[model samples]
Target: MNLLIQLTDLSIKTKQLELLQPLSFKLYQDKPVTILGQTGSGKSLLAQAIVGLLPSELSQQGQVEVFGQTHDRKSLISLWGREVIMLPQEPWRALDPLMPAYQQVSEVYQCLHDLDEESAFYRALKDLERVGLKSSALKRPGQLSGGMAQRLAVTSATAGGAKLVLADEPTKGLDVSRRDDIIQVLMNSAQGGGLLTITHDIEVARQIGGDIIVMKEGVVVEQGSAQQILNHPQHAYTQLLIAADPRHWKARDYPMIEKKPVLEAKRLAIGRNGLALSNGINFTIHSGEVVGVVGDSGCGKSTLGDTLLGLLKPIEGSVKRLSEEAKPYQWLKLFQDPPAALTCSVTLGVLLEDLVKLHQIERQRVAILMSKLNLAPELLERRSTEVSGGELQRFAILRAMLLEPVFLFADEPTSRLDPIIAKEVIELLVDLAKEQGCALLFVSHDPYLIEKRCDTVLRL
Candidate 1:
């Protein structure tokens, strides 16, 4: 088999902190490989290392070669889009927020060949439709559901001709139907090159249909066909991973928790440019009540959020915040990718301090919040890009809590997280909201979350 990528004694470290141990693997131009690991096992770090996108603070000791060319951070510029493509764990990070999804995806072709706007957009539309995001072409990254945003990123990464594709959790945040289509797209794209997918989703790993590498603590414990590794995993960690899917977990009903209405939307119509995506929507969120808004992609779930947060105007309806003295972040909204809601250029420290400055938050209180959210104090020093999604989500929650909002609008808050971390974050949100009597407007495609966590659900 012709080699597309090779790693020789490759390892990753963050200032003496070993993120990945020395490991060797070979990827052929026509073969696809799945790397399975638990969260924090350095699966993502390994992908970054091979792609030459590791942060400057992190160091690597090893040789990485792509298509017979030795690669380092500087050397990658010569072969970026044409030879190597990386689909990040967080798709939002890979996309440009300032541009619409269509325009950003169109740039992929513009990079390789000079094309007119119409032709680039035509190609963008075709590819996006393949991933089920053609309808979201005009939407910005912020306007899409987590799953939609992920597909948009796929459209870009897979657009340019490349010899090898490295995807980290590409199927994350997607529903079962879309997940299958996306897997097929990535696999079809790999017909011309090597496809190495790093995912915690065992189902995703299985459906992609290829060799599997079981990783634990950055060590390759086992490598074999998907049938052997998934059905009969040799490694203990691999077995654990295979058993960790949340889809099989039975949903339990919970007693409803409801209180006085904190916010109410009457006859709401959500849309833009004199259009209504969904109309006649009426919902009321009571303080201490967890309300789930469930719908399919393009069902106006996020549009309702924008309308509620006053980010989008209601074509014909009214929204009332009963709480007096409305302040910033009071009706706080958390999207699947919270970092997009933050200022990418600023450090977490600067954002946190600015938010809590008026309240004169004490160090002790800050520590308490961080501890509750399971975040390290040092994370405050890093930018949004440096921290992982779960870490930044915790900080986003912390920032929202500092504002002491009467209500919180969470749109796909836990969709991007791992099964275990997702459970923890959702539980934490409920517990914290109950403690503060802050109403929750939860939107998710997972029906179980609505049944278990929310007191009542509003369907669109």
Candidate 2:
């Protein structure tokens, strides 16, 4: 077997965390490999380390051989895109916010082919169309939905002409229908080269039908064929993953409040470019209520969240926050992907402290809120990059809660979390609304979470 990628006894150490302790794995040409792990299992760290993007302070030991060449610290950086391309979980974060999506994709092609603008644009458009995106979506990353942005990332990575592709939870935010399409595309790439997928979704792994490498904490606990691993998982951790599927969650009655307008939107027209998503829309969120807004991937859920937060000004209509509380009010808007909303350089603690100071919140109150949210105090010292998606979402919620906002707008708050963690987050939101008399407008496509936690359901 021709090995395309191999890692032997690899270990990485950060100041506060040890990632990939004595990990060993291999990816063969024309074969797909899936790395299964929990939320903080260092799946992303392994991918980053392989692509030579780990920070300098994090010491890496052992061997990382690619294409029969031994790669150390210095050689790995220069060797990244020439041989291996990584599609990050938060695709839009990898994009240049200022550049249009078409231009961004064109840049990847230009790096590989030295093509002129017109040729690059034509190639980029073809790739975009291949991914089932419309030509009009040539707008910036901010304009695309979470799923669309992920497609863009895949298109861009493939365009880079790399022999191996490393995708981190590629289907995390995609809807059921879109997930199949993206998975097919990824499988096609594996047929052409080497594909390494890091995901918690066993169904996705089974669909691709490849080798499996199960990781726990920082070690690979199991390795076998896809059929063997899924059909008969030897490790208890892998079995636990199979059991924790969201479908197995017990359904409970979601409490609803009396219709008293806590927050009202009158003829709200949302969208960045005068392209109204829901024209002349009107809604009211009452105190002690949790309202869910459900729709297709790009159907303006995030835009609605932005408008509610006063971050995006509506073309026409009024948003009124009706709170009688004398205490300073805070509005926390949790993004679909925490990386998009959070700064990479700042630690979680510094971020919380900044929010506290910005909102003039007391330190003691912030401390109490952090503890209540189940976030470890140590997380405050680590940068946003160090935290997992679930932790970052919780941290974002805690920051918002620190200000004691009367209204909380959560956009896909549970998208990145596992079923249990997602349930816990929903419970926390319910408890917060009930205990603090705060109103919540939660947005998600997961009908189960909506049915379980929402006090009122609104379909967009």
Candidate 3:
């Protein structure tokens, strides 16, 4: 096999700390290398280091050679799009919110491949068609679902026909069917090129079926072939990671079923921008019950939640607030992407302090909730952008739970988390909602997770 990238004792460091331990590996043509680890484990930093996109505040040690030649940060810039492409962790963030889906892909062709506008458009259209996105050619990123956005991001990133593709959590929030479709796209794109993937999803690593590197807190815990590592993992952490998959979770038994109706939707028809996606939906959510909403991407799962929360108007029917005692502040939502929900302008501590003061919430309750959410005290010192996704998500939960919400809409809250942490967060949400007699409307793409945790499943 022809070698693509060779890392010799590659490590990342901040001024005061080492983020990634000295690691060595070789990526070859046609073979994908997947790094499996939890959030804050330096998996993303490693990808950044390879692509010469590490933050200026951080420094690196050791050597990195791509395509048999060593290149520094400056030299590597010349290779971007033409020879190297890095698909970011958040597909929505990577895509231009205002640009049409086909235009985004066509732009890559026009700029990197030196094609005329007409030719680029034609090629981009064909590419989208191949990925099952031809029907969404005119739609913008905001209009598409999570899975469609992911596919578009990949198609646009690879349109330049780069030889080395580094994808960071490409399948983070997608359903099983869409996830497999993306995997197939990546595999096809890497037919003769090199693909390096960074993911927390063990199934992604297993499906890629190549070399697997497991990292924890910047340290490489284990590395081997996918079959050997996944099926016969020798490291304790690896075993723990494999065992954390929701498919292996024991079925939970929820006993307390309160009769108090918190929210009821009758003949609800939900949609966005005057477009109806689902109609005649009827359900009554009782206090302390976990109701899961499951459907394929773009089937109106999130729209349903927003309509019930009164964030969006229902096209038809009505959502009744059965609990007259509950205040507007008692209704809340936990977003799928924590960064979007939080502001980067303020430190987490400041946000928490403001919330406490505005609500006159007791200091003891804040401390207790923080402890229960497993949020570190120092995390409060940093801005939302300064923390990892998992930590930031816990902070979101801590903020919401502090309000003592009577009704909570959790929209795929743990979709980006590692299985181990995802399970913990799910349990915490379930237990806390039960304790407070709160009603939960949870949306998830993972059928296994919904099956094990939810009391009732709402198929859209």
RMSD of each: 4.5, 4.3, 2.2
Regions of candidate 1 where Cα sits further than 4 Å from its true position: 1-3, 13-15, 28-30, 38-40, 51-83, 89-124, 132-149, 161-163, 172-176, 231-244, 250-258, 320-330, 340-372, 375-388, 399-405, 445-448
Question: Which candidate number would show the highest TM-score if scored against the true structure?
Answer: 3
User: What are the TM-scores, per candidate, against the unseen true structure?
Assistant: 0.77, 0.79, 0.93
Kindly list the per-residue Cα lDDT of model 1 for residues 147-231, writing each as its tens digit.
7888888878888867788889988877667778889888888887889999877788888777888888778889899888888
- TM-score of candidate 2 against the unseen true structure: 0.79
List model 3 lDDT by residue over 103-193, tens digit each.
Answer: 9999998998889999999999999998778988999998898888999999999888889999999998888877888888888888899
Which lDDT value does model 3 have at 338?
Answer: 92
Give the Å shift of residue 75 in candidate 2.
Answer: 5.6
Where's the lowest-lDDT run of ten residues in candidate 3? 252-261
Candidate that would win on lDDT: 3
| lDDT score of residue 282 within candidate 1 | 86
| Tens digits of lDDT, candidate 2, 357-434 | 777877888777777888888988898888776778788777766666677888888778865567677777778776
User: What TM-score number comes out for model 1?
Assistant: 0.77
Deviation of model 2 at 41, angstroms: 2.4
